[model samples]
Target: MPHFAATLRTGLCATVLATALLGLAGCVVISPFGGHDDQLRETTVQGDGDSKILWLPISGFISDAPSRQAFGLVQQQSTLATVTRALDKAEKDDDIGAVVLRINSPGGTVSAADEIHARIQRYHETTGVPVIASFGGVAASGGYYVAMAADTVIAQPTSITGSIGVIIPSVNAKGLLDKLGVEDASYVSAEHKDIMSPLREASPQERRIVQDVIDSLFARFVSVVKAGRPNLDSNHLAEITDGRIFAADDAKRLGLIDRIGHIDDVLALARDKAGVDEARVIRYYRGRSAPRSILAEAATGSGMNFSAAGVPIDLSVDSNAGASQPLYLWQPPGAP
Candidate 1:
């Protein structure tokens, strides 16, 4: 009788647990779509009627990827598509009078940065909206490259703002392979075909060829800087473009940035440029068709599980596998 009672109890507990899970699942599924009309009605314009400054954030490493959705959760990597969409939305919004690009990046690919810069320029020209760049913790190389499209660039007093140069980093595993008694037997068409092969050392001639490419890209970078900051002294051009970083104050003195101020100051500058007495500040967020559920989070292992203090740990590793390419990026001290 005791064993039968125990079996009955186990069955009851399982039934209850299943019921509870079903209830939670129902809540998660229904919450996102419930009261759609009410949600639409609640969507009201922020601050005063129309005349607003759009706050567009450009954070993380810039790339031309479609989206940064990882594990079915949004990762805060700034991609070309996201930035372009934000600019398009701002351009169409009649309420938006100006744009403030809030940048906090150590730079990224040359092509991606150039594309974003071109898009911003087009948006400004098409809509006649005054765009201002507000620098955060670190804005260097391609980060600064994109900011050149803005009418004015502002940086915080302590912001690390410059590392204007190109770099093409490569790793040679020949020594490691030699130690491990592993040899590369792969065949190639020509001697210089495997230009930056990790299995072998680059020949002097190959090194010269790579240097020529770098020099050409460097000259292009110089031309862009010269055109962007026309007031920059010709004498100091070589000195500043030598792959060295600078603080915000030095950046200003060197004509890299316009002012040393915070986001509020940037907003005020945007307001003045747009000639608006009082304007609302609106931030554009990516719209979602459906809200993520706890079940989805559990299945994909999304949301924060482990953190240091209050910051979630970043487990993503950057494996720059495949061919090496030139990058207009700033590598911080001790970065691999």
Candidate 2:
């Protein structure tokens, strides 16, 4: 314990010294060490430009925190409020031509995703700017909901996209608790006081109640998908949205995505979609602790394509940085 405390103290002293040295040099910058948030990038580009292209990368499950450690990182890039502010700014800026959302994520919470979709739609309606959805490695479930707002969609040939479904996995350790000679004790003013606790398996009635909540949310997901992608065959809505992932080629066949391409391809597609022969392109990132040029995301885990607007990026382990944990709940965390 003493040794551990000494190590923490040493690390703290090193950070302080680093800061002091940088302050003295007037040019040096202290690097973020082994902290949870150090793995993500949050630099958002938000200025008036002649460019018609706007790239927004989804690097983590979006959630509802704006802390530097939460949303402001090198890996867990982008957030709900940041995107909202950027889109709002773009709408007011006549110099900005169009928007392209470069998505690479696994889906998250229904509410956050819907909020972003609504904001994108509002920006489009207000600015008369065409929004293009470009799937990076993947864009699944809630991520695709935001994409549905796009005037057109693009994806990589191998990009994993789609998974139009809702899920809220609950865990119960009551059996384990019993084995350990323990049980949870609680007092409740309402029947749902323990709704979020996993110490005990939910009763059948409780399970039904939770299912109803998820179902209502799922219906909204269906509605958004139906409303956003009109060209998609309406009959296949329920069939495709069974929380299944699709390859770009198959997705295109299903009308889930319009075409197959990468970032540069997305820019070109945006140009054609916006009818701008020479469109200036810009990207919107929240902010960056370290510049992204030196950073590259780790590889995909599952060989099968997984889709979401964003998934976690891990920076501590990768040669550069790994997938990150996002602040917004629009996407889930690395599965426990």
In model 1, pairs of residues that clash are none
TM per candidate: 0.77, 0.72
Summarize candidate 2's per-residue lDDT along 1-336 as a digit string, tens digits.
999999999997786566545544555343454323222222333333355566555555644343222122222224577677667667665755668877766765566677888888888888888888878776887677778888888888988877777776556778999999998898788988677477877778887877787778877877877777677776776678777788998888878878887766776777776677766555443223323321243221111112356774322212112222211122335644
lDDT of 1 at 239: 76
Candidate 1 lDDT over 89-168, as tens digits, reads 67777777888888888887778888998999999999988889899998899888889899888999989877889888
Candidate 2 ranges beyond 4 A from true positions: 1-51, 67-78, 285-334
**Ten contiguous residues minimizing lDDT sum, candidate 1:** 36-45
Off by over 4 Å in 1: 1-49, 66-78, 287-311, 317-323
